[model samples]
Each structure stands twice: as structure tokens, then as C-alpha cells.
Target chain A: MSSSTDTQGTGAYAPALESPRSPYRRGKPTRSNWELHGWLFMRMSGVLLLVMVFGHLWVNMVAGEGINQVDWSFVAGKWSSPFWQTWDLIMLWLAQLHGTNGVRTIINDYAERDATRFWLKMALYTATLVVLVLGTLVIFTFDPCMDPASTLEVCRTGSAG
Target chain B: MATSLTPTAKDGPKRPVGTLYRGREGMWSWVAHRISGVAIFFFLFVHVLDTATVRISPEAYDAVIGQYKNPVMGVGELGLVGAVVFHALNGIRIILVDFWSKGTQHQRKLFWGVVVLFTLMMVPFAIRHLTFVFGH
Candidate 1:
């Protein structure tokens, strides 16, 4: 339906495009609704991140003596419990994935050239994988009593410390 | 034949004057959200790396983290708190804009609400955190 209006050159009134709600399927759903799912995940994960991140900030930067209290012993005290371990593990995964997707969107928008876009995303994904793995391992394998000269309560007991 | 969409002075009145979203609260909030999100993401990478130092040795971890207690990094932490606060609040606004039926209609008002909430939360945090950082 190339009407006269549709044939206008630059600096002319735009032609009306097809409605997004149109029933006609455009070449079988290719990406398998990945974009839709990503959109939903951003919202869902965003809400969770707000809570976890705020709690983290409060505990580490606002409570007690604040940042000064955050030392190896402080970390040992927190991670010694399974609860904080789980809290941190989930927080790590959610925050990383959420941030990665957001950066991926930015890369797609600004990196006009295909090679630039591809390499940017490649770097992002690589960093994401590394961070996730390292964070996870740290949470799981953390041994508060690893140091023989440690004097933490848990370390003194020769336990989680 | 107009081969390029770029409007030139030759086009006269046909050239667009300004963007539709420029100078609007919604636009500003959107810009702030993007900037904050990017800043937070980069910080997250550094945070993870620094935290991994715990696995090395307590002295190493303590030495590295001690840098944050310095005045320079203390101010940097304040800035980071500002970014995280804005991104978190604005993200909730975006969630409402997407899910609530009347969200788009009130998006401007919601952005202002985000600003107000950010200010409220940050004031105490700044006072408390700065005290801890500088008190000792």
C-alpha cells in the first residue's frame, strides 16, 4: 500500500505504520520471546535488588560503626552464618544478571556497527561470567577460620568462625 | 532527491528545532536513571574483585578495604551511594510505569516522587556515613 503520503521524501509528513497489535505474525517468533522475558526479569529482579542492596548498604555502611566496622572479622562474622551466605549468593547472581542485561541494552543502542556491538557484548558477558563465578565461589568456599593465627570467636572454636 | 534524512539549513522551516522529550522531567529522570545504572554496573565489577581478596589473606583484604576508609575513597563512596539510591528509586518508578494502568499518565509526578524519596533517604545516609568516615 505505497500511497502518495508514503512516497514523500525527507522533511515530509510520516507515513502511518502498522499497528503493534496487528494479528498478522511477522515471520515466526524468532527470538522465542526472549526480549519479553528479559523485560519482565528486569522488573522482578529490580524489586528484589532494591531490598537486598539496601540491606547490604545499611549493614555495611550505615549500621554500627559503619564502613570502619567492615573488616575481615566483620566479613567472617557475617558469612559464618548460612543465612548471610544465601543472602549474598542470591544478591550476587541477581545484581550481576540485572546489571549485565542493562549494559547489554545500552551497547545495542549506541554501538551502531555490528562488530562494535558484538565485541562490546562479548566483553560484558565475559566480565559477568567471571564476576558471578568468583563471587559464588567466595561465598561457598569462605572459611572464616582459614588463618591459623585467627582470633575470631568462630576461629577460636575451630568452627565456621 | 533527498538522500539524507539530516535536516540542513537549506530545508528552512522543515528542520526540526528541538527534541520532543528535551526539557521535560520525564526526560531528565530517564537520563539520570541511565547514568546511574551505568555507574553502578561498573562499580559492581570492582566491588566483586575487591571482595574476592578475602579469599587471599586477611591482611591483604584488610589492606585493600582500608583504602575505602581514606578521605578520597570515602567521598567516592558517598557518590556511589547517591547513584545507587537514584537508580533504585527510579527503577521502581519504571516498574510502575510498565505495570500500572495509569502509570504513563502520571509518570511525571512519579519522577518527582522518586526525587523526593531519594533526597529523604540520602540526607540521613550522608550524615551518618560521613560521620563514620570522618569521625575517626
Candidate 2:
């Protein structure tokens, strides 16, 4: 069949005939590579989230005094250490990115109109950015003993203020 | 009277419209992620506020948390746990969709698979959490 087609094309060719133009050329730049990177990020973040989330749970719910131990003092004590602060920071960033990218994909898929897609994405990104910034700030700027003077008597006992 | 004489527009093509949700797997992954994200955000807000109670007074903190020791709150905790678990698991699904060559083909299957796995994993974890908190 291949030989017959070759012979037909060569021997019976009309020299004056023009080739048909393709309707679909390489149109727009491909975005698949960027998408692939996003996909990879989801899995890596998910795996890391698994560890960070579970570790958080274990420490708060399973270890030491268990759930009862999780009070203001408990959080204050935990955040006082750089270890817990860093852990929380990692969790916050990973979860935000994973969640944001996931939603961005959704918005791209569901929002039909260009304006709708643009607005929704703008809102999503804005909200994500705000929350991430606020959360990181809180984690780093946390102060357990703010009113040290007025509440010194109570603070001394590790209960009141 | 005018309504009865009007002709209806015929359905155009069988093909769906819009770039949004064109891929089944990608669409669903996007959905689960958003749902989970909102859930986590609200949860974090409450958690931070709850922790802030300690700043007010220890008794207030204890009282707020003491309420969480109840059955209803235990159930709520389970819901939170479920949200976290589903979000984390589906995140893996999103990652697979990105990295795998055949990910598009298997997207639907993988999405559902992650959902099933999330439910399976969360059941025991949630139960254990509730038991630890309220079973006493």
C-alpha cells in the first residue's frame, strides 16, 4: 500500500497543482510545561503537608498532656521555640500554595467569560496573599506576655494575665 | 399569546463550551482544593481566636476549650480533621496530574481514587481524635 501510494504521487503528479494549506498551525505558545510544574508542586506540598499536619496533631493531641495541654500557655510555649515556628511557617506556605493553585486551576476551567475568570482569579490570589501574609506575621510576631507590668502578679503564677 | 407563536432556538453542537472545567480531573481537583482551603481558613481563624483567649484569662481559655470536649464539638473536630485530610490527599492528586504524562487520561479515576482514600484515611483518624477528646 505504501509503495502504491508513492508511485501514484510521483508518476501521476500534477505539477501545476497547489498544496492545501493547514488550518491549524502552531497557534499559541504551549503552557503545558508550566502546568506540569504546578502539578509537581501539588504532590510535593501534599507529601510535606502530610508530615507537618500529622506532626502538629501528634504534638497537640497525642503527646505530653494531650489535648488538655493545648491552652494559651501551650501555644505560647510552642511558639517560643524556633522549631515550632518554622514548622508552622512551612505548613502555612505549603498549604496556601497547594490550595491556591488548585483553585486557580478550577477558576480556569469553570469561569466561562474572560471577565469572570479574571475577576475570580484576582479575588482568589488577593485573598490568598492576604491570608498568607497575615498568618506569617502572626506566627513570627506572637507575644505571650505583652502586658508584663499590669499583669505581673498573675503572670508570675503562669495562669492569670 | 405571543409566547405560543415564538420558535425555540435549536441546540447547536454536542460539544461543550468554555475553557473552565474542560478537563474533568483538573476541574474536580480544583473544586476539592477550594472547598478545603476555605474550610481550613475558617478553622484557623477560630483556632487563633481560641488561642487568644489565653491572653484574656486562663479560665476563659479553659472554658472555651472545655466546650470542645463535648460530643457535638467532637463531631465538629472530626469535620475539621476530614477537611484537612481531604485537602492533603487531593493535593497529591493535583501533583500527579501535573507530573504524569498520562495524567489527563487518568484524571477522573485518580480524583475519585483520592476521594475514596481520603474518606478511608479520615474515618479512623477522626474517630481516634474524637475518642481522645470526648470518650473519657
Candidate 3:
């Protein structure tokens, strides 16, 4: 090791100095790959949402008598078709995922404490799961023509009956 | 006078004093995405409530739907459509940032791309939406 001994202080002095080192340090690996997947999901979901949302608009607003024609019957009719069912299923799934991922990212960025992050995410995930599952169930399991006797008066209309 | 340097002090962890500046891409994109998400969420609440009107009373349901038939509400629908369009478009931008390592490099471009695409896509769709909803 080449040592520079310089005596230029008040007395003849050479302070031993530690070797110079690089400031860069190794960082812990992040689950950024998963985040990357989620990112891709947002874009794909956005594209799908565009289609579902626009198609929904066109059908509800322009295709038929437009907004005036949309009623309980109209919804029932739409839900009756397997095509609309699938469309709605896709929309629900994508929207939930897109929204959930967005919130997840927000929580990760803002929740500084581990406990806070955990609880917030638990709540978020719980709400998301409940809504998504319930929505999907409602869309698919909806009985347009329920028993008139047990249903609302509107469902018991002569035309409906 | 002799002052000894302590190894522990020299090796002590340097705590960041202020907000750590992670060399990330533009913060505006994140902020926009967040704002749009919140906006969409707000609309979602209203939408679910409005749709739930059907369960209350058919007359009430029809009344709510009729409210949407007005010119003012029609304009509001246009704005809602715009919000969804922007949020979806910006969401895609956020996704691109997540997947591509080089995405941060083109953040400005991506942001502008989303804006342009949103406008182009939304214009025709919006016109069709308005006409369809209110034209007849």
C-alpha cells in the first residue's frame, strides 16, 4: 500500500486515513417483477375497459331507442343474452382489477408503516373481493322474471306476466 | 491536542434528512392517475346508487333515468364519459411505466400520447353518445 506521509500541521503529524471507498451500496431486491406484471395488467385492462365501456354506451345510448328505452325490462333483456352476460363479466372483472391495482399502488406508495400498510391493504382487498364477487353473482344470477306473487308490482305487470 | 476518530461514528448509517428523491419519472403521471381513480370511484358510487333506484320503485327509477335525459345531465354524462376515457387512457400509461424499464425515459411522450389518444378516441365516441342519448 502506498502511504503518503505529509507533515504540514502544527507539529510533524500524519493522520492515518481510511481507504477511499465507493458510495454505492447493494440494495435489497424488490418484487418489481410482480409490479411490472400489474402494470401490464393496467394497460390491458384499460384497453378492455375502453371496449366494454364504449360498447355499453353505444348499445344503451345509440343502438335502440337510446336512453329512453332503458328500463328494468331493458336491463333484463340485456342480461338475458349470454353475449351481454359475458360482456358484463369481462367488464366487471377488468374494472375491479384495474381499480384494485390502482389502489394497491397508492397504498404501497403512501402507507409508510408496515402495520398501517397491512391493515389498509386487508381492508382494500376485502372490500374489492366482496364487491367483485357480489357483482358477478348479481349479474349472472339475476332472475329477470321472478315469481310475480313474490316480486315487486312492476314485475307483476300484465305485460311482464 | 489529539482527537481520535471513532470508527463507529464513521460507519454510522447516514439517515436521509429530507424526503428521499428517488430518480423516478414525472410525478404528475402518478398524481393524474390517482386523481382520475378517485374521480371514477366517485362516479361509481353514484352509478350504483342510481341503478339501485330500480329496486325502490319503478316510478322512481324512471324518474332518475329521466333526469339523465335532460340537456344539463346529458352534458354531465359527456363529462363522465370523458373522465372514464381519461382514466382508462392514463391507466394504460401507468401500466407502461410499470412494464418497460425504458418507459420512464419516454414518460412525457407517454403522457402526451394518452392525452392525444383520449381526445381522438373520445371525440367521435362522445358525439355518438350525445346524439344517441339525446338526438331522438
Docking class of 1: medium
Tell me the lDDT of candidate 2. 0.72
Tens digit of lDDT per residue, candidate 3, span B39-126? 7765664565566555555467677877777778877877777777777777667667777798777877888898799889788867
Higher lDDT: candidate 1 or 2?
1
By summed lDDT, the worst window of 10 consecutive residues in model 3 chain B runs over: B16-25
Candidate rank order under DockQ: 1, 2, 3
Top candidate on lDDT is: 1
**Model 1 lDDT vs. the true structure?**
0.88
Q: What are the per-residue Cα lDDT tens digits for candidate 3 across A1-161?
A: 22344445445545556467735546886645787777667777788887898798779866777666887767766765789989987887787778878888888988999999999889878767766766677676665664343354445565663
Query: What fraction of the true interface contacts does model 2 reproduce?
Result: 0.27
Tens digit per residue, CA lDDT, model 1, B77-120: 99999999999999999999899999999988898899899999
Candidates' TM-scores?
Answer: 0.84, 0.60, 0.62
Candidate 3, residue A11: the lDDT equals 52
Clashing pairs in 3: none
How do the residues A50-143 of candidate 1 rate in per-residue lDDT, one tens digit apiece?
9999999998988898989998888888987898999999999999999999999999989999999999999999999999999999999888
Off by over 4 Å in 2: A1-34, A146-161, B1-38, B41-70, B90-124
Separate DockQ for every predicted complex: 0.62, 0.24, 0.20
Model 2, position B103: C-alpha lDDT score: 73
Candidate 1: residue B55 lDDT (0-100):
93
